[model samples]
Target: MGKAMFEKEKVCFSFRLIDMGNGSQVIDESIKTPMDALTPELQAEYMEVHEQLAFMKTIQKNNRRETERGRKLVRNPLHRLACFCGLA
Candidate 1:
């Protein structure tokens, strides 16, 4: 599955599954920022959250069969964030 988020004319974020050519797949994430648009503090915070998401993706990838707990834990935070942002 894939998803893309847009802001104005730009794609702010996206992710998709990529075939690695070795009978494996990987999740690829793309995060984009407008030049000089974000304040230093905001940029730092964004990167921190991005790192956390990356770590979570890694965990999910390493565990071939996702446990119910793992699935819920990974999804709940994102669901809450979406709801908080009025997107859910």
Candidate 2:
């Protein structure tokens, strides 16, 4: 009976926000819950919240990567001037 129920719902992904020394850390993890242990309605709510939180973290990660890339591509005026003088 227990095995049958788990096979139906499958495993879910969960995200947790942790506070570190400087900033917050987002952790993505696989969570296994026995759906039969909770009311069906509550199980549905939990899974919904889990997926939304994971999606939020993914968005944050992509934005941070884009910001870093933009910084690297910036032109340094001093370097450009030196190169123009053939000092480089």
Candidate 3:
């Protein structure tokens, strides 16, 4: 008979949950923006703006995905509301 390897490895997590009454979600601290450190040099300032813009683009993309997912979840209720209120 072969010995079973059932040893469990240690895992760590720092999850945080936030509720907004209607729904709840997990928060990730890594998404937070860093402190601004702009310099007087025009090129450096432009580069900083470019970097911030790229970061914003990434965040906006993520928001679009999340919003789509949320809309999917609430589609039934929203559609019913639209029909009931004659807004559709």
Candidate 4:
């Protein structure tokens, strides 16, 4: 017989807070369980999505840093001098 089918009474949304500077992440949001869940496949898929999201966050952080570095390399001496002397 096929695994018993069950419907989730309520859908749950999850969120995470990440500190891109240090590559640290925390799941600050709560997770709700599903109803009449069949095999463990669903759970596995959910975890996979979160993993992908975390990876993307890390990549985004790195990209931002690289872009900033590139901009600094193109800085004008006049601008740098202004900041150094507290005048623009």
RMSD each, Å: 20.1, 8.6, 17.7, 12.5
What TM-score fits each model? 0.36, 0.45, 0.38, 0.44
Error of 2 at 74 (Å): 2.1
Query: In candidate 2, which residue ranges exceed 4 Å CA deviation?
Result: 1-36, 75-88
Looking at model 2, the pairs that clash are none
- Number of the top-ranking candidate, with TM-score as the measure: 2
TM-score of 2: 0.45
TM-score between model 1 and native: 0.36
Candidates 2 and 4 compared: the better one by TM-score is: 2
lDDT of 4 at 18: 37
In order of listing, the candidates' clash counts read: 0, 0, 0, 0
lDDT for each residue of candidate 2 in 20-55, tens digit (9 for 90 to 100): 887855444553445555577867766776788779
lDDT assessment of candidate 4:
0.64
> In candidate 1, what are the lDDT values of residues 1-88, reduced to their tens digit?
3354444465332444356979875556663555256677855755665677789889987775567667786579888798789987
Higher TM-score: candidate 1 or 4? 4
- Point out the higher-scoring one by TM-score: 2 or 3: 2
- Residue 23, candidate 2: how far off, in angstroms? 28
Which stretches in model 4 have alpha-carbon errors above 4 Å? Answer: 1-39, 76-88
Better of 2 and 3 by lDDT: 2
Q: Write the per-residue lDDT of candidate 3 for residues 1-88, one digit (tens) a residue.
A: 3345565433322222244777854445444322232234633544555566679889999999999987886678877798789987
